[model samples]
Target: MSTLSLRGIVRQFGPLRVIHGIDLDIAQGEFVVFVGPSGCGKSTLLRIIAGLDQPNGGQITIDGRDVTGTRAAERGLAMVFQSYALYPHMTVRQNLAFGLENQRMAKEEVARRVAEAARMLQIEHLLARKPGQLSGGQRQRVAIGRTVTREPGIFLFDEPLSNLDAELRVQMRVELTALHKRLQATMIYVTHDQTEAMTMADRIVVLRAGRIEQQGSPLELYNRPANKFVAGFIGSPRMNFLDGQAVGGRSVAFEGLPNLDIPAARETTEGEAVTLGVRPEHLAFTDGAGLPGTVDIVEQMGGESYIYVTLANEARLTVRRPGQTQLHAGEPVRVAIDGAAHLFGRGDDEHAITPRRLP
Candidate 1:
């Protein structure tokens, strides 16, 4: 296990700056995941950590040592890329032993390491097969096994499951988490998929533009997002935002919906413009008064249903309802808030009022 710290990390391409002054500390044996949209510099940041790409500025340290100038080979880290970069001509056994042999390790030690890695990865039976003969998941396992044979201080994964099918991706997620538990090595993973980050990481780092939006446990970010972007980004159905004005100390007045008093932990201004963020799972069809909208569409997805409702002001709202629903298109629906909600100010000014913690 290894600890890492990054200070004032900066990256630029000509005049366009991507990463700006990122300072982060990663503890020993923790699995940290970097998540963001495309072109958000997640991969670039991972590369900088791996010493594959030199940063335009800042420092990288590992285990109390200044390793900013260290080469990738000496960084004590192994990285698995998205493409499962396997040598097609070589069998799995040769591929796993290649790096150890290049270091001139004894043939006995290399063989032992390869055997152990193959056993750990459950690829012992497939050791004689070449990359071209393996399935996508099997090839990925071989790629990971190649890294495991080296036994570096930290393991880095760059969207290593993006190529697999949905079922395979889920299966690999469980396998990778189990692998992390067994190895207990420090890991830094970069992925565009938030689901992957949520499930596999001990902590998730959310990036936007070039800066760190927030970093915390998955439930921490989901339950108490630091800002509007994060509140909207981390969840599956994406929190719905309604433009409204703060009124009556803790209440917000929207045009179509009734004046809703928020359970705010902080005081709200009397007439400040605010956006009310509510998750689809937090809403439900109400028998009494609620947000009046017309059901635009209903997606019956076996165990659950997704209801798309168009509010009176033409804003689209999605409500995730558990189990089957008889509701169809063009039906009138009144949705009420039943769970968590957030409030934000205009122009992404953090949370206008932080919500109260639920019992």
Candidate 2:
């Protein structure tokens, strides 16, 4: 296992800077995930860590040793790419042993490592098959097995499961999580999929346009996003935002709903613009007066349902219900914002204004 650190990590493509002074510390045996939208520099940062790309500035440290100038091969790290990158002609066993052989390791030692990796990955039976002869999931296992054979201090994965179908991706996610637990190796993963970050990471770093937006545990980011961007990016179906005006002190009046008093840390002047954020699950259906809307769509997902409604002011909101609902399209519905509502100041820099409440 290894502890990795990055200080003032900067990357530039000619005149255009992509990574701007990133600073992070990853503990030994920690599974940290970098997540963001496309062109957010998550993959670029991963490449810098893997020594595949050098940073324009800043230092990379591994196990308390500076390795910014070290070659990738000397970094004692293994990376699995989105593409399997396995040699089509080479069998799984050969692929797993190729690196060791190139390093001129003893034949017995190389064989022992290959055997152990194959066994750990449950790909022993497929060791004799070439990449073309195996399924996508099987090929992925071989690729991971190849990395495992190296027994590196850290493992890096760059959207390794993006090539698989949804079901296979989920299966591989569980497999990778179990592998991490079994090996207790430091792993850093990069992906645009928030689900992957939420499910697998001990800590998640959310990047945006070459800058760190937020870095925290999944629930921390979900329940208490620092700003509107992090709040909108971290959750599935995303948090709903509605325009409102601060009536006074802790009272805010929604555009099409009654005024409600929420816990706000800062005092707001009367008639100040603010955005109200409420997750789908945080909005409850109420029989009495509330935010009036017309149900536009309903998505039934086995045990739960999502009610999509258009409010009087044309703002759309999705309400997540625990069970199947009889609510249908064109039906009138009223939703009351629970105490879990988040309040953010409206502007270019939309920071959260609501006090953090216990979940």
lDDT of 2 by residue, 129-179 (tens): 999999999989998998999999999999999999999999999999999
Candidate 2 deviant stretches above 4 angstroms: none
TM-score, model 1 to reference: 0.96
TM-score against native, each model: 0.96, 0.96
Tell me the lDDT of model 2 at 301: 97
Off by over 4 Å in 1: 348-352, 357-359
Candidate 1 yields a Cα-based lDDT of 0.90
Candidate 1: residue 186 lDDT (0-100): 95
**lDDT (C-alpha, whole model) for all candidates:** 0.90, 0.90
Candidate 1 local lDDT, residue 94: 97
Model 1 poorest 10 in a row by lDDT:
350-359
